[model samples]
Target: MTPSRARRLLPPLALGSVAAAALTGCGPDPGEPWAGAYVNVTAYPYFDFGAAAAGQSHTVLGFVVADPEEPCTPSWGGYYGLEEAETTLRMGEQIAALREAGGDVVVSFGGAARDEPATACADPEALLGAYRQVLDRYEVPVADFDVELNDLQDPAANQRRAEAVARLQEERPAGTPLEVWLTLPVSPAGLSEDGEDVVAQMLAAGVDLAGVNVMTMNYGESRPDGQSMVEASAEAARAAHGQVRELWAAAGQELSEEQAWRRIGLTPMIGVNDVPGEVVDPEAAAALNAFAREQGVGRISYWSLNRDRPCTAEHGDPSEANDFCSGLEQEAGEFTRVLGQGFGD
Candidate 1:
């Protein structure tokens, strides 16, 4: 399982700030190269997406899944409905604040913890409507679907999601089209057969995919025994880059090598990974950032902003993967600072 899935299955844990106000929307242009970290909206110790950290101001707030009681309805981590989240979680305010700070957010759907709307709502129209609601509410230009675990193998769910997203795009007003990205699990070898199929389904369904952001962590046995995390992740990204180009070519859309890399994103699980003995330390993060910048990788994001802090005494053991803190010795926001370098240039 991916880190996000594993972390969610564990017991809940507790878990930003402003920049040059004049530079609002000064980050990468829409559909262009960008970087940010994931924020578990309903997680504890509410994160401020509006604040700038490490020269980066963009964020991907997510895992919005179907409401447990009402599958067709959208909820924040299945804990609060859209309206309730606005009032209780201050989601709207936070997003507004982030945008005001000249940053933007990508609302992610379908996470490991709960059923994505498409998985729960079988009706294509209903699924489309569910996705539309969230997109309209957030008014975001980008949406990420983090498909993993069993969801990756569910062909029916995958097809439904692809179709729904395609229709959602068509229905959007011109000049305000939505860019959909699939955030999938990857290993050093790159996308699994299921992951590739998911991409093919999206392309076949006519969804103008923005890119494939590989979760470059928790490689388990995929990482060569002696290779460092950075090396392994770099390998995984390179492999995925090739696969993405081939996949697009097979779909009748040929892209150059540079173009393929531009359509690729790398998101590592910062600090300790769910897999034992695998840790992305601060140095590793900086190396990964350097590699990304050198390769012109489109996006660089970590598993979470919530886990970016060091494990404090109150947070308990630093050896285990905790929900709130990264099980590593580092300053707060260290990963973001290191990984965000050169992004949004």
Candidate 2:
């Protein structure tokens, strides 16, 4: 995986250039609380810190480091940075503030819509180096790879990502491991083949993955009519756990169902999922929370915190997924409160 000398010459991301930071499960040290939600960095100030405080979602998974504008380069969705007009807040400063408030951040890379470094960076060593630079800048104990769709289907990129992360783990300081979670698309049947393969590849690459976070929402054309979203999510979690156990066992490290569950994370879209007619309401959130606790699941999060409130006006089709509200009838932070139940325990 050695890169050309020219590639090695590429400088690390300038710490000051990156914007806001994030958090989730910190590596195998196990004490890090896993309940949280994705918070977009640019949505800061508008993002309610009070809800996070109230819900006890001390860890936030921030989206995203889109893709390198160039090889081995890292940027926050290709727009946000320390530049004055890029964003009104500094990521480091905001992260510091969150830390001060007794919270933390874990930055997630890739998403359903963005180009990811694994898919874009050709040199494996350079890509690994780029990820290292991002971790160094953020100074967080966890990172998430939100691979989906095309990126999820690309085995080459998936293998490269696993190797890169394995290299990072090898370089970690003793007792200061970096937790890596692969967040992938899921359905009631559980992780798609590509999702299972990603986990297998990571294990094969010697990456001690901290967990697998399933995006258990928006089942879309795959979902049956009138199916409970909560039930769908639970089924998906169980299926994923089985897949992880089999993969780990095949990799010569058998994990009990409970062991696998502790490394599992559930993230349902808060209110209206992108799929028409699918909604994960407060009752569903409560059910998921109970399920998470009973199963000892490590993390529970929603699509976002910014959308924790009910839409108050006809800004758009309140029935669809939007930025400001959860598209459901409830007080602000209701979903947060229910889903984050037992958080910080």
Candidate 3:
């Protein structure tokens, strides 16, 4: 077994505490959890981070992946580089505004659409540098890695990513160490074998993992017959909690049930999921949120803030997954309002 990473002296901040600190104009405690939704950084019809959705002040801006052209360079959704994003998309300004408004953002790396940096950047130093650039540029306390598809199966890439992130955490000062979370795909049964390996690699590499956030949507054939999306999501999270505890035990760390739950995050794709006939309505979202609160789940988020609203005529079909809007009848931010309820309370 790989030696355990040196544990930080400071305890991780809870989701409520982090929100409270940010609202009070203080920097967040180095590590913990929070509730929010993913914002597709380069998606059409830009989202304003300064505005709180349903009084929820935190968000995860995502898909900062390797630039196809530069390989090691980071770009927003493979389109806008850091500087270009600031100018073209007002990316930096929006984040600054959000922080100024007593809100915080967690920059997410990788997504289903593009290659994570490790897939393209083979050099360990270069991979580390690529991650460093984004974290430093955002000045964020938390970073989420949404690993999926072929990228999740690449052992070389996963090793490089784990090492780079581990180094990133170790290099930071104790007071402001980086908190990393691995976002992986899951089904009702729990994390796939590859997903388990990903977590193991991070622990083995000494990445002080904040938690494992399973994408609880799109179970496909894994969804049991007659099960609702909410039911499937809840089952997946519950199963993941046990798997996470076991993984920690294998690494010489034993987490209690509550501790394990606090180390798990659930992110469901709101409205119409990519899979047919799977939908997370507002009521389902509320039920899911209630469950999270009751169980002390670490964080709650959806696939995107961008798609929280009902689809318009321009979006074509309301039954299909649309990037710009949730494919159902609902007010703008309704899902956010429901899911974010009591998040930091």
Candidate 4:
């Protein structure tokens, strides 16, 4: 979708202001010995084979499925899952590639696009059971899920879900960790000098969280501020940690107890869709990765490994879906390989 001329005028006008802001699957890619290091390279509806090859490690690397329905389920994310046969099969092909790489891929349970709060909220056991059913279907012990108060507040209900997962982890086998992804928006609505607004809730929910992913790339339809998305995200994670877990650090940058919660993960977008020849300077990507490293946060996920860039940034069109990422998707090719190099395996 194209942006109206009026909205186009807003960015330059507010340049000084600014703002910001999962899991599982598969085997590691073949090329390197990157094992056990967290990597999240994804596709909207499919994971590109080429992209996976570059991002995989012997350790940990996975995909956070986009859950976009009432209570969007990440494993169910993308337009392809519901298809009768053909499309679903195509999606499975991507899944197969992820598995072959020795990476653990997971479909994220929630995101900003999700609206339906946890219907199982009132009954803790029921929610856990329901989520478990998800595990049964995917054939994985746990799925990466996010917890924001909009759906899981009310301390009574909150504790139930938390207890369930914490129990699940303690009881489950050694390798399983219910990783989750949450956003720390530059939009002030979710972020703060301290990111406590949502952290308390997540911690209250459970223990043994494989990790947390804070999306610091700040391009949203609402486009709040034009500040440093990287900085805002790092701060939020630091503030989010409570008694249950400790903030490791930002994705590449390190932080202090006073600054922000150490994010468990970072998602750097490779221009969403790259400009034909722009090849978005690697320095920008490296700086973000480096920042996360400083924070002690070691994982990184790219927005996607699928989709083709059908347009160009020169279009001046304000983009309907947070245009910043409009150009990143493409057929498996050179761009995918280039984007995968940041892992430093």
Candidate 5:
């Protein structure tokens, strides 16, 4: 196993006793884990590279291409300012970013609309047919893709996606991971209500049975009335249909309320006011880090560095890239510590 990275000691702010209490007495125990962040290469590869280079551990990123031509072709997409033959150029660059930073990389597939038409995966069988090609391209045990029962909302489509995921899981050598992107709100009831009977449909289809990313930035509309940060996000996630049941099936034990979230997922994948009606909360961010540790969640990803922009609000002025960079740099260590690195820096 990789040695536990050193930890950080956060300087005290004018924290409330409650905040102090919140921060007190909890972190993952000896065997719990901490993972790094997912840098989205689509926005700015160089910047993404730089974030990994800073030594945060366990990076998961997507070099997604908005290339319409090879839409959903997995490894062979033909856009993103470079030609198709240059994929290794992309992967090689990402690999170097991690190796140089002492991190491991998981090549991601599917971004908002980057792989639309997903012509290659229109249905279950076609996707199974195309798996080997994607696997060979990324050369990683975990092949990442977004499969949401929320997206299609059609029961048949959800089932088709599930079967395809199951088939891929079966085909891959054991231990190879399959991660799905989930965009449900912080509560199952809200997700079920607004997401067109999400709970019933997904449970019936057996969708979301694999690992998940839980796409968690909410500018609002998608998030229902009172859910914003990841603690709420995680609570919402656990409340989903079949989640606890799925936990039972996967680990053969009932996940204590705390353990229902072991999937590699999203966290301060930061969002700011740029998300209309969205605001920032350092306290919530802290709670989120706390929540992940409490649940023994597997991995956490930030939806993007590009969206929140760090602006003067979170970091500094938009033009000064260092503002954005520094903010992440400052929080990264505390995040690492909260996520469960042994000692603090």
Candidate 6:
């Protein structure tokens, strides 16, 4: 989703917290099993934060933050501070609950609308410190970098991010390794030059990057008319697989097609995309799910869990990019049921 569009869809913040049962002890265990839909946390109320435990997702990728006020200082939804956000949104509690239920979270550091510490912080040492704080706070097994637009354009910031992460991995305790995932924008043609550069820099810095998760929606002018979103996404994945293979080889980590494809991830925007005429309905989701399983892709996720339901009559324009519903005909959790099948298996 576009940053401007995200700003419009998110609701105003209210300060508070809902008390719930919490899980004791938190730390990364490298042996933990993770798979299934990766739902974004901030898009709540629509998904009923507590109720989502019963859904198909085995992992929740919390929207942007480890420390909201570190380095350049970040905030949730451009409003509440990270503390208030956790208190009011019960994000930490949700993580505890998901973990108690045998699921976990991968805290994401950036998104379409926010400033991640990677670009905001100039000092590599301080950036590494910021990442360390986030890691220490959540003790998550994995973290994600969602780079887009201007962030993708800055080479220096990208390198700084890679260096910081490499340092973090180097300093990790003997048995626990924090896996990193680079989520980037894609078209039918595949990863852009900037996208490939991000991967190259990470490899050059010796960061143990788990893989690349391509955002396979909003093709804009790149997708041909009459082509299904499923077809477009499949073609994009194929293109990304090839690019990753060639880039890795250049970095002296030559990998076969199977190895390259296995390290690839697919994240299509659920339902109608930011661009019109690009809807990922149930049928399309099933096709993508089948393809993901066939390729043994590393991960399968969508833009959000909040937009997983059908738009109601009381709701406003379906094309307005509202975060509460899919703007398409789908029952609650139906999209997850269809798209998340066999994921993380």
TM per prediction: 0.89, 0.85, 0.89, 0.57, 0.63, 0.86
Tens-digit lDDT track of model 2 for 88-168: 545665676677666667778887655678888879988887788778877878888888878888999999999999999
lDDT of 3 at 188: 94
> For residues 55-123, could you state the per-residue lDDT of candidate 6 as single tens digits?
333554545532435545544444445677678767678777776665566767777766667877887
What would the C-alpha RMSD of candidate 5 be, to one decimal place? Answer: 9.2
Better of 2 and 4 by lDDT: 2
What's the residue-level lDDT of 156 in candidate 2? Answer: 95
Model 3 stretches astray by more than 4 angstroms: 1-32, 52-55
Q: Residue-wise lDDT of candidate 5 within 1-345, one digit each (tens)?
A: 000011100111222222223222122211123354555444322344545334654455554432454433444233443344346336566566566666555555444433422333465555544554555555554445543323334455445544665565555566555543433333323244433343334334444343444555542565556766554465555554245435344433443333334433444444343345444345555666555544445555554433333234644453322313323323443434443232111
- Candidate 1: misplaced stretches above 4 Å? 1-30, 52-55
Clash list (residue pairs), candidate 1: 15-44, 15-45, 16-51, 17-51, 17-52, 24-102, 25-102
The total number of steric clashes, by the backbone 3 Å criterion, in model 2 comes to 6
Tens-digit lDDT string for candidate 4 (1-345): 111112111001100111111111121111111112222222222334434453354222232222334223423423323232235435445545655655445544444332222433345555565556555545553344443334334445445545656665565666554444443333323343333334445555545344445544443433335534444444544444331133322112233332232235555444532212222224455565555444434345554333214334653442333322234344333333343343443
lDDT of 1 by residue, 102-202 (tens): 67788888778888788888888878888889988889888999998878889999999999999889998989888888999999999999999999999
Clashes of 5: 9
Stretches of candidate 4 above 4 Å error? 1-75, 78-93, 116-122, 147-149, 152-160, 175-198, 219-263, 268-282, 307-325, 328-345
Better of 1 and 6 by lDDT: 1
lDDT (Cα, tens digit) per residue for candidate 3, span 19-109:
3332221112224456788877665656565564424567788878999899999888888899999888788778878777667778888
Q: Which ten residues in a row have the lowest lDDT in candidate 5?
A: 1-10
RMSD for each of the candidates? 7.3, 9.8, 8.0, 10.9, 9.2, 9.2
* Model 6 residue-pair collision total: 1
- State which candidate, 4 or 5, has the greater TM-score: 5
Ten-residue segment with the worst summed lDDT in candidate 6? 10-19
